[model samples]
Target: MDKKAKALELYLEGFKVVEIAKELGVSQPAVTKMLKQFPEYHQEKERRKKENQEKARQWRNEYKKQKREQYDEDYELVLKSHREDAAALSRRGKLSDDILIKLCILNYDYNKEKERLVFNESAGKRPADLPRSVYVHKNVLKQFRIPTRQ
Candidate 1:
């Protein structure tokens, strides 16, 4: 094939100009000059780039959709298991109203601690807009090396 045809073919196959030059036994500048003589090759390259970008966008959207669905399913399963465990404890006379209240308080404290840990680890700073009562749990604050305000 001629230089132009060979260059176009190599470009369509994802070869860089340098690689095409090596394959065609021409200098890089000469290969560039020849390719520039054909505007259609540049157009084809742009079209391929746009098509690849669209394909990547679609793949990312599909992946995020799949992940969101999976997260929803897993969250539902966890909620159901927690409800079942609570019910089982109630049936065995192990769960009382006061105990349930305490459990809720503990759950709130655990979640706050987890949020603080994640925020501190990521940002290396204290969280903003938090009320004093939120950080009243001394143990959690101590773990993060945050001094408690009196």
Candidate 2:
């Protein structure tokens, strides 16, 4: 068959423009120009684009679902540790309902903060709301004999 026919076939079979160009031993623009001659070319390309977008959307949704499951598992582990700490405090006669509620809040806050930090770090961006350095009084560090950041 002719180059146009072969190019059309490859394009309909979902081959990339560059691949079709290589197969036909022609430049990419030439292959594109040839494909443009056909009425169905743009239609097929748009269909493929939409199909790829749908696939990407599904992948992102699955990734978010997995992350949610992992978050749940991690939160459960944190709660278990908090419960153990509360039990220990109770054994020492220091646990209170108010303190237990505070522990749960702390656990929730810690997990959320940790998730935010991890996401920011992975995305190669710093959290805009977080300070780069904490402001600690020099006198307190000196009293504790702890090294201070300049």
Which candidate has the highest lDDT of all? 2
Best by TM-score: 2
RMSD (Cα, Å) for all candidates, in order, is 13.9, 16.4
Cand. 2 TM to true fold: 0.59
Go through the candidates in order and give each one's C-alpha lDDT: 0.67, 0.69
lDDT of 2 by residue, 1-150 (tens): 999999999999989999999998999999999999998899998999999999999999999999999999999999999998878687658655344434332222112222221222443454443332233333432332334489
State the TM-score for model 1: 0.48
User: Over the stretch 44-126, how does candidate 1's per-residue lDDT look in tens digits?
Assistant: 77888898999999999999999999999999999999998878687767664444433334323323443332222332433
Cα-based lDDT at residue 30, candidate 2: 98
lDDT of 1 at 50: 100
Candidate 2 clashing pairs, residues 3+ apart or interchain: none
Cα lDDT, model 2, residue 101: 33
